[model samples]
Target: MTTTRHPDARPSVSDPTGPPGAGRRVVAELLDLALLALPLTVGALLVDTLADADGGGQTDRVVFGGTAVLIALGILVWNRGHREGHTGASLGKHWTGLITRDRDTGHPVGTRRALLRRGTDVVTTRTAAHDHFTPLPPDTGVAALRRRRLLGLAALTVLLMLVLLASVAVGARPMSFAEVYHALIVNDGAETDIIVHSLRIPRTLLALLVGIALGVAGALIQGHTRNPLADAGLLGINAGAAFLVVLSIYLFGLSTPAQYLWFAFAGALTASVVVFGFASIGGGKSNPLSLALAGAAVAFFLQAMTQTIVLLDQTSLDGYRFWVVGSVAGRGMEVLWQVLPFLLAGTVVALASTPALNVLSLGEDVARSLGTNIVATRVVGIAALTVLTGAATAACGPIAFVGLIVPHIARAVTGPDYRWLVPYAGLLGGVLLVLADVVGRIVVRPGELQVGIVLALIGAPFFIALVRRRKLVSL
Candidate 1:
């Protein structure tokens, strides 16, 4: 039982028992197949859930579907991609104490190599007898990781508060701290009172909600799809919502955000269903690739339809252009109240799903073996994602980048753990959005850029840098 040591990394444990027997390998492969089939089984159930629901249960449907999608995908990626790449073992391999190692250096195979080997090994069972295996690392750094994540969350919360203060204090019309305080507590009906109470407060609150929603939504999207580049829009929520808003303007002469809010929400929820349905078309299973492709196609089609309508109707064109710019400005408490329930529901579901997500990220077989309900967990994930993204998009017209970029920032701090990543992303998102809105107000005094535009301006450069700096991996 000689251990092969690596100076640069963890050493591999040698087994005098030689390689795993053919029966073990066969069982492992079968387990892997079951894991792969889990998604399809869940997708089939999801379709049934959708078909049986009534119109009144639209929100419920969206919530369940989105939540389940994320959980399902998270499990798939963790089991198949991250687990094998980072540790040198898949679920089956872990069970059988099998591992892929460098043929030359006798080192653990990295992600790229692990993935390549997965394909080759499937075709041919032949493995070198010299191959060594290691069990999953113990939960050594968990406490440290939890402590760090908690600290990061606290820091983000504080930053969010500061940004909220800035959002309230600094706007097109600057109010001194005392004046702002007076407006809230005193309410003497002065100019500052009207500005603070009527304008900045609601706008700031809306931004806060939108930020948290987009941020968490982004994190969930990345987790579910296992795509580093995936964002809230990957599910077609934004485009679907925007398209309906425009359509409402064109056909019904709806001019206000409140008027179209429901329509947008409906569109978003509908789009999520459509994406899932399309993904589940073949063999009644929805994979991440199928979901992504379907989402993209649906989003593009909806956008094109929206454009055609906007171009044809002058009234719609005017209303659509402004609404599409994505601003929390001019929206009142009523708008916030309307979307608050969905946001709250989504947030709760998302947070609750994180523990299951953590388990799912380990692998389906492991999760099942540990008593995690694969179907229910995934349904909850997909549902949470739909509600969050739909509410955010409905509240503020498809703000880009917040969902696309905030998760990456959160992931960098929290590592691959979704438990911390989702909350951190939400807090960071609120801070960034409120901060961006404040910057927009100050930079162009007497006028302000919409929050959506500001986010795009900031997000585009930062995203480009993120891409240049690192590889995109779905945590």
Candidate 2:
């Protein structure tokens, strides 16, 4: 007897070709488990160190440990959702050449269905066969996705502008929106005008510039390295700058940001080159794992050196501590002026490198086949990354996670295209930093939380949520 089949029907599960075997999958899961535990481990270590130094009571330890545990649980759940939900691949999966896709359509299972699939998989874990497929809806086509992205971006843009305006209006000395507008336009001999011109406007502009720089730099770094966790700080840029800034203070008594700007820039560039050089040493071409490991090693070394220098000199430590925590406050037009040209140059380079990045995303062989100059493209990207991250770190003392978190947010809205990703990242980053700065001011009352501290507080949960909500392993 002959079997009949419909032309449109496809198998619910394909022949497991290229699917990671159980052992490989287990290894990948272990790797992901390690990554998930990393933050909690670091937090615990930090708490222990601080407690030991301060001779803290058990109450302090208990509170800190409890908080850390809650945060860790949230992160774990969110990451699990993201890995199993969106792309059906976690960090380990990406490294191991595993993918979760609809067996029939061969498309990603997507976030919602993926969550359902995960739930079912957890329940049926005792069974022999753990293989499962979540069907995807019919393709909506590229144009539809683009349209949705555009709409989302436009909304975010509007929201960002509102946040900017609010940043301009709210501070230690609050002003009405009308007052802010009046001060900007009129500039009479009023106190508000002085505050607006001399303090608020410059700070807000600096925030915008720094945000754009870090955001673009992050997108470039992630694209070039193909690592979701890659950031300027991770590459030792921040540690390098901080070390040089401390050295300048220790040696030459350079106190102001403007005085140490060049030192920071030079250090950042030098560190980036060293990291890349080390990563490239054994390579046919430096893969993401090599780059990430090299960066981590360099960052740790530089940070250790900086700590030693600071510990040896009390005066230098006092001066360096503030900058290390990262803030845009107290920065004037001079520091902004110093970093502006470099930031502009980096932005231009980043934008121009977008096409190359898009091609490179398709894998090196494919990019070369399509006539891409892979070497030149990487060089340009690294140059841009150095300049952008270096300038931003120089200006703002290494504000954490703007580079790491903003790009992921932008990517969610804009999809994988670098052209849209770059701009969206820039705009959203500006919003995030400015908003964070504003929150920092308000949260601690008359005294302010440093923007960096506030960002870490906010970004940690968001990062966990993002990991839970999206599939981060794909190109």
Candidate 3:
């Protein structure tokens, strides 16, 4: 934890400076996100628009096939984002006009330190449509950054409101902005008000909340462990959760989403405990790779147990599909609300660890000298990570690549400050997931694909790029 931050820190004022290559990377990231969104968005709208009320066969093909396509596109972008984000934010930083200057030293950002900037940008500057990020004149570098960050934040806020408000206006059924606004303000259910209240508004809010929560959790876990390759399922949380669900179904005969959810959460927590116990073993303690391997081993063992239990009777498989596939469909606002306490508490815990994380990046000896309690931080971080990821996995069935990927992107955008990184990662994750979910809705003509599949498709290439970069760039 050799890193340091300025509480009074402010963005630099300038014309969002960057290296020559930064523009290309920014364009690439934008293109990737857009490409993934485009096909899925169009496909969903197309399928929903064209599908027969009777759910025709042709519509099914279009929706399902499109969903597959959407997944592939999402993967492409996600993979690219990870690569670009992690490789020192190269072209993306330059082009985005965001610079990752060191916080304590007040100089250009070092490799790991860059994540801090991204975190701040993602969280405060990039989240929700707020007027917070007001740009200063370009003559001052810090002022400019602050302004850009603020602008970025404000722009994002407006963009999000517009996108969601627009969706409410024009979804399975369409509404004008005025009409939707009127419904909201009046709080009355006119013919139009019913559609506004029931379908688009709730779903839109749900999307934002889910996306933010998932994205933040993903970032937190990846950064906490410093493993770009790790996913929520890395430690077999899903397998464990699934086993519990299987038990609930075959032995207990409880198949409802609400009933099974608790069992799954319990299983996830149990798996996390086991995984961490193994990781904390040995003389020095487990690093990223060691922890991942341990998780994978635990997951495999649990999955075997689940399979064995299910073999006794075929009745358990029915509950497995819907839970295992990881969907945002058919869930109520209450479920979202129920999981939020865990999410909020976990988020706070994770955010509190940022400063220590920065110091740890400098090497253990340095971090220790700088007054960091490596042991305490690790234990707390793990606990927080376990809860956040486990809750998300248990609630949503192991959404993939997010924890692994979003932090990389966050790192690229901001810098290595965990403070900035956590929020940015979370916001980015939210945006990405919500958008992906939307795409899944339209891609298959009428059928939908799972976000997990889409993230995998997008992330596999990114995983390759990460390996390649780590191979090429040593520390």
Candidate 4:
């Protein structure tokens, strides 16, 4: 008989012909579980402390405890899928020098298979541990990916310019291309010039700014957490802004967009800080699982409070409804001016962090080995996300799905590189929002739908298609 040794083989006395024994697997899992639990424990303590400081009763403590537990479970779920899916190695497995591979092909498994394996292990606890797998094709080279990204950016830029023109041209009042050009260039004193300068131009600019901010924010949130489903709306940012806008209307009778803009911005910033703080309890670094769970918990809590207040007062609801629906209309250059600095700063931060994000995506161990400062990267990323999301929400009343959908579309075109993804996402986001605004204007004629409503209509179907196709987790 002849024996062959693989290049990466490690000898095991107990399992001479196979993988690691069940005992080793269990021990590795226990270690990983302990590591995962550390942050949850810290989060629980912090939540308890905050509750006590706020003079919260037993009920509040219980609520916080329950939320902490839910977050822990969410973290477990996220970790199981993410750690095993991407590298075929959980933190414990990696530490134990045990790597999972396809049983049939003896190759690394993709994210879907890893998730399935974890799911099966949960459901059929006593079943024989076996897996069947197929090998993945070779990866595309970096140069090829870059070329594709460049092409995508070029295409998206063209689309965005067309949409910007359309946004300026098609509105409650229509104007010809010639009139639009003349108004923009010649500064003619015609009715076209008044509409273009006074109404369409400002709103269009606002749309572009809001779109860029939301898109980049969404990308940052998703990349930082390594969660494909992450979005500003899902993370309580939009709900937070909505809650404050509602509060301002009910308490202070703030009617104009300008009056509630600062309130909305403050609310957004607060929500982000709370979410980050909760996620960073023990580790000081934001884990993907913690971020998602914290965001969800905050979002649900704020949304409930907002709904309760709106239901209690009809006048507040009437005012809140408009803001909650999220439109770029009725905004002028002043609104743009107010948010431009924050948005610009956020955008610059996002672009600057792309390289760090790229490194961070390669798992913490790899990132650390490559000399990446994981904590600093996460802090910068979160700051960018907060500023961008807050500015956009303040300006546009929390437009949905621009952040969620645009990045996915950009990713499909640009692959997983953040350098290309950020710019592409920003451009695509502007295009999508402006296009949605134009469609909303046209579909209802003089009675236009808000951009948020239009996006929900468009984004829902696209999201459904993405899930059905199982492409949502491509990142």
Answer with 2 or 4, whichever has the higher lDDT: 4
lDDT of every predicted structure (CA atoms): 0.77, 0.78, 0.63, 0.78
| Cα shift from native, residue 214, model 3 (Å) | 2.6
Please provide, for model 4 over 1-475, each residue's C-alpha lDDT reduced to its tens digit, 9 standing for 90 to 100.
9988786887555433454568878888798788668767965774555343443334324434554575676566556556655556666776765666655555555666775673222111111133333234535888777777777778677667767776776666645557777888998699889998999889999999899888999898889888776788656788888899999999999988988999999999999889889998987767888888888999999999999999999989998988888999999898999999999999999999999999999899999999999989998998998999999999889787788888888887777889988988888888888878876775555578899999999889877786687445645
Q: Could you tell me the lDDT of residue 360 within candidate 1? A: 78
lDDT of 1 by residue, 1-475 (tens): 8966355653335434344568877887778768867765765464354443222123223433444565566666767666776666678876776665555655555566665664324211224333444424634487877887888888677667766766776665544557767987999899989988888899999999889988998888887777788897888888899899989998899999999999999999999999988988976767678889999999999999999998899999999888888888889999999999999999999998999888877777898899998767766788898999898888878888998888888887788788888998899888888878876774454577888888888999988887886555545
TM-score of each: 0.69, 0.70, 0.67, 0.69
How well does candidate 4 match the true structure in TM-score terms? 0.69
Provide backbone clash counts, one per model. 18, 2, 60, 0
Give the candidate number with the greatest lDDT.
4
- Runs of candidate 1 with Cα error greater than 4 angstroms are 1-140, 368-371
Stretches of candidate 4 off by over 4 Å are 1-143, 471-474
150, model 4: CA deviation in Å? 2.2
Residue pairs clashing, model 4: none
Q: What's the CA error at residue 29 for candidate 4, in Å?
A: 56
